[model samples]
Target: MKFPQYFSLLIVSSLLFACSNESDSDTEKSGIPAVITPVPLDTYFPPITRTDEWETVSIETLGWNENQVDNLYTYLEDNDTDAFIILKDGRIVIEKYFGDFTKDDNHAWNSAGKNLTSMLTGIAQQEEFLSITDATSQYLGEGWSSLTIDQELSITIKNQLTMTTGLDYNVEDAFCTDPECLIYLNDIGTTWYYHNAPYTLLDDVIANATNTDFNSYFSEKIKEPIGMQGLFIKVGYNNVFFSTARSMARFGLLNLNQGTWDDTPILLDTAYFNSMTNSSQDLNLSYGYLYWLNGKSSYRVPGSEVEFTGSLIPNAPADLYAGLGKNDQKLYMVPSLDLVIVRMGSASSEIQLGPSGFDNELWGLINEIIQ
Candidate 1:
């Protein structure tokens, strides 16, 4: 019965036009025209130094509209944003801190932490520690849920990653991971609900599969090698990650490069990486292993049953994908544009789990400045 949140917001619709301009005489003589290809910018291949500091690019050098950029910042401030950053070709283009927040201040990624867990799960699979196709009970032991052993064994790690565990989310606390809380709703792989308990249990899956603590495994596999700084802390039944804005950017950069950092391969499973970022199931074409995708024909939001038509963020590039969390902690990347953006702060007045109206509005502002 849930309704769409931004049903009335303006949807920007503009097709990217690729054309060639040539002299009429030449076109008539050859029956063809030369198409000019844009020279690739050096920013496209910026050095990936595994250091704390990142190289930066000036707005003037990028030729972005200054007045519009100011307007974008003003809009962000008005919306209670704490930290905002934009990376072009892995180099910082715009970085800003508002109120008392500083570059070094840590912020919780909330549900966005699921993206990290997804990556680690893939890494575990690559190392032959476990296969995602294996049943969840394989690692967590049987009877972890109140369901029968066969019913419990029906759910697989990939189902948890894709939110297709068919676990009942109608309990008193959706976030509760207790056996009593995880009741079965539909059969596995038949339903897609943004249930939290099944997703939260992935930490245990990774821990048992690797025979190491979740945080330690993450540190050894991803953080230390990529120069990322963060730690996952337990909050109630949820394991939320806290990290600086730049650290979040580093993760986005790693994903943007298809699981490689500075030519170092962190996730060697190309097939898994492709499947993780692309559509993982038919129920949610706009969702991939914990990541949200744009440019899809339709999308469904968390806590809502209605599937809205068109792209998730109309103003964003068609190739845009994101790790969006509560209160709009966002890690957005557009592969075609070679862009990465991060935003961390309090929730907007209107709240949803992943993509929201704020996304379209922010992208509108970005399009203006970058045009």
Candidate 2:
């Protein structure tokens, strides 16, 4: 959903590469090319002047089933969902808050907020504050990690963005930010693991590079501009974001429009936007900068070394990409349908860091309604 134009550009480049390599007849494709259905650019971005003035559309108007509405809510409520929303062309088709949770109540994004950090990094890079290729120590300074100067210097922002920093995950606490906890596992870029220490350090890198606090920079660049009402809180070693469900949907809308808020270009670096949402590393085809991509040939989930052999969510759209959190918080977008879906709540039962069994089960239920 982030880049329809980039995928169009990719198709052109891929055709050239596919023809040039006689050896790459079948297995060596650059990207999974698909005919992206045109997203409706006429969609409205909710104004910040009145935060409560978002537009709405009915599912019946979109030819979705009314009978299944009850089924959808039933599943959401039964599974401990606090809020759920489905947007078509930036207009709400369904928005519901369960139990004591209201539309304005704040819920933690957990790991889904990693998408917010990824976007801010892109914005920072576009403004020339930093480059992803630069050694992380350039900002974090030497000895930020237990690695030697040379070893630490070998790690780049791109490595951290792609989860290929080769940081040790076999620790007593993977979330620990101390230098002693960041032991070197393999050579930089040679291994891929979802180690949080390297990722959490990205806040320091952004703060040092931009000469601004991460939260301040985020507010100035993204939150205030797009009418988003959210704040990042330092929780232990991580900076987790919290916002109302509607604010989360606003971000989903922004991403659906390729990092734009109406006519204003919030993140106009098309190349960086493309890279942020597409495959950033070969080791995990389903991961972008911090987003979970779908429709790739294979994908590896968090905390697991084994690679699964299919799309991340089999019941969902092939082009769906998402920001998934530890407790089943989800932000999913499908460009073909001009759709953005967000779910924020407590975990269905246990805390899982996404691509969980609930994803398939929920999407299976959603399929019946959307169809």
Candidate 3:
């Protein structure tokens, strides 16, 4: 029921050309109208090889309603989507680009790149480079935060991973990593706050733990293995990751496969993988290690203490865990469905941040097909 809107248009164009080329003899031999079927979707074969080739499957093969595709694209186009992709079993099911944005163009992951930090953290742990339970100061050194040394000692690497670092969220700049900016909000592990400073310091954590440069280590450990092309670029106090849409899909597929690529294990620590995608704390039922979890009975969002009652994306599958970033950058992984979805571009609306109405509305369209 779900496919990119462009697919049907391309097929219709192909059909029109076919009809024009048809001859009486050809028609007589067929005794019926020529049917145009795209061989590239499913028939192309294999998952992405990181080459120019990426296999695709036919919407007809999945029996999804093609009628909804146009509507989906209409909504996307209106919302300023630059690039969107849906991968099934690691094969691309839907890939659409808008305006001048193409497969080769780079886009920022925004906060969705936090998922990359989460993955690298796990890899750091797996390789015995760091432990999530270790105190943050143990790696970053003391006085990293304005908190008293005793109070600072209480903050752990797991706290950063879970957004429970107890760092103040009311500061003028939540993204500020300066020690003076990272004020103490509450006792460590007491509350779940969505602050970016502690999360961003994780860059230092990985770099220090691995005794190597952050991006270099990332490229060597995760990117190269999965054939991802992205690097963290320093922008003010934030180190934002930018890459092509296909690269985002590749990372989603890696998580969909539970940290494996082509049967090769990238994250050997099974426990970290399990914990990374599940609730890391009781305070936030809909959050894992920087990943937004769906299907929880209740959820919370950044800048709000009020817990909203419902799944993170009610229209999405219950098992979906996503990396939602600023301006609606998205990377969704549904293990149950063996699906990975990626969306990248400018904000569709004025309200910019993760988990907007855009998510629920878009999923409504997705459900029309996938359901």
Candidate 2 lDDT (Cα, whole model)?
0.89
**Candidate 3 — worst ten consecutive residues by lDDT sum?**
38-47
Candidate 3: segments with Cα more than 4 A from true spot: 1-49
Q: What clash pairs does model 3 have?
A: 1-64, 1-65, 1-369, 2-369, 41-56, 41-57, 42-56, 42-57
Which ranges in model 2 have alpha carbons more than 4 Å from their true place?
Answer: 1-41
Best by lDDT: 2
What number of backbone clashes does candidate 2 have, counting pairs of residues 3 or more apart or in separate chains? Answer: 0
* Models, CA RMSD each: 15.5, 18.4, 10.0
lDDT of 1 by residue, 1-371 (tens): 74465542322111112122334555778877556443337544333344545677777677778778888889999999999999988878899999999998999999887889999999999999999999999999977898888889999999999999988888899999999988888999987888889999999999999999999999999988788888999999999999999889889989999998876899999999999999999998899999999999988889976778998899999898899999998999889988899999988768777778999999999999788
The model with the greater TM-score, 2 or 3, is 2
Worst 10 residues of 1 by lDDT: 10-19
Kindly give the stretch of ten consecutive residues in candidate 2 with the minimal lDDT sum. 32-41
Which of candidates 2 and 3 reaches a greater lDDT? 2
| Model 2 lDDT per residue over 42-121, tens place | 68778876458887777666778888889889999999999999998998889999999999899999999989999999
Query: lDDT by residue for model 3 over 1-371, one digit each (tens)?
Result: 97799998999999988887776668788879667663332212234446777777766766777778888889999999999998877777789999999999999999999999999999999889888999989899989989999999999999998889888999999889999998887988989878888999999999999999999999988888888887899998999999999999988988887888877788888888889999889999999999999999998898788889989898999999999999999999998877889999888786555778889999999888776
